[model samples]
Target: MQIKHAGCYRVAVVMVLGMLACHTNTRPPVPGWPEHFGFGKTATARQIDSLNISIAPDGKGLPAGSGNAVAGKAIYLAKCAACHGETGAEPTPNRLVATLHDTARTKTIGNYWPYATTVFDYIRRAMPFNAPGSLTDEEVYSLTAFLLYRNEIISDTLQLNAVNLPLIEMPARKYYVNDDRHGGNEVK
Candidate 1:
């Protein structure tokens, strides 16, 4: 009985030691960087262009089609009025148009956006806040048209798209100038 008890104790001790040994404090080695970061393959220009829809400030990548402010008003009431309000007043606290105080005082679309193309560009990228990039090109154009019209920047009958978008000049266009500062004691 004593011999059997001693053998059991030895076995239990060995098991515990084995478990302790198995639990090491070492971490695995970090993975090395890839040799070719997946840019060796060339896609067709058409294929690349399909994915790239960014429009420049000069209206470079704008699609064909036009929308008038009158048309835009209906679309705005349907899709945007809930958030941006009936007159872009922002009843829910997201002002799409500037207040009277904002005009000629600070940077609102009506006050300081340099070009109308920016409005179209921004709406094309992000608008309707909750549902971004969901508007059709015509819908975006219409929204831009409506906002511009509401701001009294353009007439309701005016059509807006790529070709005509750049033509609608912003009131604050002349005030902006490039920052000439470089990194030294002064910041650029």
Candidate 2:
């Protein structure tokens, strides 16, 4: 009986130690690698398209629809006022539009952004910080129009969308010049 009890204790101890050893030796796999990456094979074009929503300055990935400054004001009040402020003039956690009176003092969309498309692309990609990409294409257009109008860049009734969005000229557009990096040795 003593011998049996001792054997049972030894078996339990071995099992516990084995488990500990196995746990110590194992590690979680690194993410983003192919086989260790997704559930199965590579994603299809349609699947890729569903996720790839980034738009370019040349109107590359822009979706259809239009939005006006007046319509955008409502959307802004509903979705953006929490973070961007009521008039888009108030500085919340994030800077929305710049004040015309203090262009030298404040950095805003009107004072800093080089292109109108940049605003569209940025809002499309990141805005309503809490819930990114939540706004529809038309909402984004409206929001852009509203902000631009607040900044005095565009009229309140001006329509904004993929086609005309790129055409809207920004005040700070002239301030930007191409970065002429001659070589790695020194920047000219």
Candidate 3:
């Protein structure tokens, strides 16, 4: 009986050790070479900097530059026309302009966007669908101005800049209500 008890103790110890040694995390693999993976390299600062950029609705993250709608027209024709059409009057769902009204607004920039700076931010980060994030700050400002002008929200000669972009209010600004979500046991 003593010998059998000793053998059972040894077996229990071995099982616990085995379980501890084989434990693993169940989450998806991180972006690094695991113990068995030896092919990929760690991400560099430059690569991270270029890819990790976001802009807020209050004109934050806007690059320094200025451009008028007149100049933007040329750039738009060359890079944006394929997707947005020449006059922003395309039959697309998010058409930039045409027959704007309070009840019949088409959700275009002039009608729906609350801040003009958002226009610049979106264009700078993602435009020219084929090649995004390649345009200079000047180009983005120009495009923003052009879109504003096409919707008759701004004059064709008005130059847009970081300083003034945030001040231009959209027609539908009164309709949007900010999210009052706060963390915890409360539901927004």
Candidate 4:
């Protein structure tokens, strides 16, 4: 049959061909392979537990330990001073402590992070730069306390535990807004 709209007919033909191409399975599964293609072994409960060390802002996953700035200072000096400096105010890119009054400088944990628990979480997850997860729970807690104390958020003697860590209000918390938006077309 003679085509009237050649462009429209060509587009429709391409669409149908594309749909058929998608539906047809060009490659069959390997004979001995399982449903998962036998790529990786299933993770054990212990394996999963080891990796599930993420701490929430509300101090949900904080391990059983407590520390103060006094203890934290020693840990920081030994582990963190090389990168974050002795006072955590060196000219490093990611400064842990900020003057708070200096608005011109980059955002430090004291002036940027919304929650105090985040300090503990980050320190626990990735810190010391050289050895990410080398610090123990007590050491991590102490480091967190030290950072908070250096940032002027907490006193030198104030002990930080899971319960009190979440309660300590961050200075920048008021500036940040919670992202309550659900899945939608909105870019923000």
Candidate 5:
């Protein structure tokens, strides 16, 4: 009986050691990796500036350029009309404008987006569908103006600038509101 008890104790010790070793062996390697092994270099200020062209609701980060709906029409026809249709009333993938205020609406610049400056920001970062981030600051401003005017949010002559861009209230602002949900279970 004493011999059988000693053999059982040895088996238990062996199993514990085996489990510990298995756990220790499965740890991940050190964080640092060489550049050749798919690691990217640190981005410089200029590189980051080019990539992070985000605009705030207050027209912050707007470039030193200005344009109006008139100028935007030409650019829109040449570059945007193909995908967005003649008057932006016919978006290929998604409907942008409904000509006038349509009760049944999808996400569009006029009735869906909450801010006007977002129009410029979105165009500057990703637009023309085929070639994103290609339009100049002036071109982006022009497109913003055009979209706003087409949606009847602005007149045809209003020159969209950093100052004026923020002032133009979007129709969809009433729908959007700050997130009021707390971290707890309440989802309000």
Candidate 6:
């Protein structure tokens, strides 16, 4: 095509090149390409179950286990006492023990956590700082019981299980407001 100006001709050529560059490649995969690296074996069902530990506020994902403050104390002493201290009264940022009655205190699991199931979820996901995601479901439930007992939220005799754990309402739950906002063109 004839162009009146050299600059216009240059612009037309650049636009054509840009459109070509933007075209998507629809070629198939090269033959004999490696699909599997064959480095690690496939994960077993049991292995996937072990890592799929997640507890909801309604205790939907809680595993089959039961624990009380009495049993939890022993487990806590062995695994958590090193960092949280025997009574969880350690001055670290991870302090787990604190009562709502204590007027002057830091935000603790007892007073700050909005859901009882959260205690179990956090312990199962990340605890025993040296080894994260290493504790079993039973041990995690036990630790949750111990912390709740120490904070005066639950009695030492109260057994924590999938059913009862969610029923136990947290003191801080009242302070939290749920976000009921809808998405997709709705005003936030």
Candidates 3 and 4, the one with greater TM-score? 4
| Candidate 3 local lDDT, 6-37, one digit each (tens) | 34654787689879878855567677848456
- After superposing candidate 4, which stretches have Cα over 4 Å from the reference? 1-47, 178-188
Tens-digit lDDT string for candidate 1 (104-158): 3434677668878888888878877789989998998998999998888889988
Residue 19 lDDT, candidate 6, scale 0-100: 91
By lDDT, the better pick of 3 and 6 is 6
Give the residue spans of candidate 1 off by over 4 A.
1-39, 90-93, 99-106, 183-188
Backbone-clash count (model 5):
0
Instruction: List per-candidate RMSD values in Å.
Output: 23.3, 19.8, 18.7, 18.2, 20.5, 19.8
Relative to the true structure, candidate 4 has a C-alpha RMSD (angstroms) of: 18.2
Report the lDDT tens digits of candidate 6 across residue range 4-39. Answer: 343364468768987987886546657896655589
What TM-score do all the candidates reach, one by one?
0.69, 0.68, 0.64, 0.69, 0.68, 0.67
lDDT of each: 0.77, 0.76, 0.76, 0.81, 0.79, 0.80
* TM-score for candidate 6: 0.67
| Candidate 1 all-Cα RMSD | 23.3
Regarding lDDT, does 1 or 6 come out ahead?
6
Worst 10 residues of 6 by lDDT: 1-10
Candidate 2 lDDT, 1-188, residue by residue in tens: 42354346547876999889976855555686554545778777568657877666766566777898999999999988887778767755466777545644557887777677777778778877889878888898898898888888899988886777777777777777887987888858
Candidate 5: tens digits of C-alpha lDDT, residues 33-63:
5434666798875686557666789765666
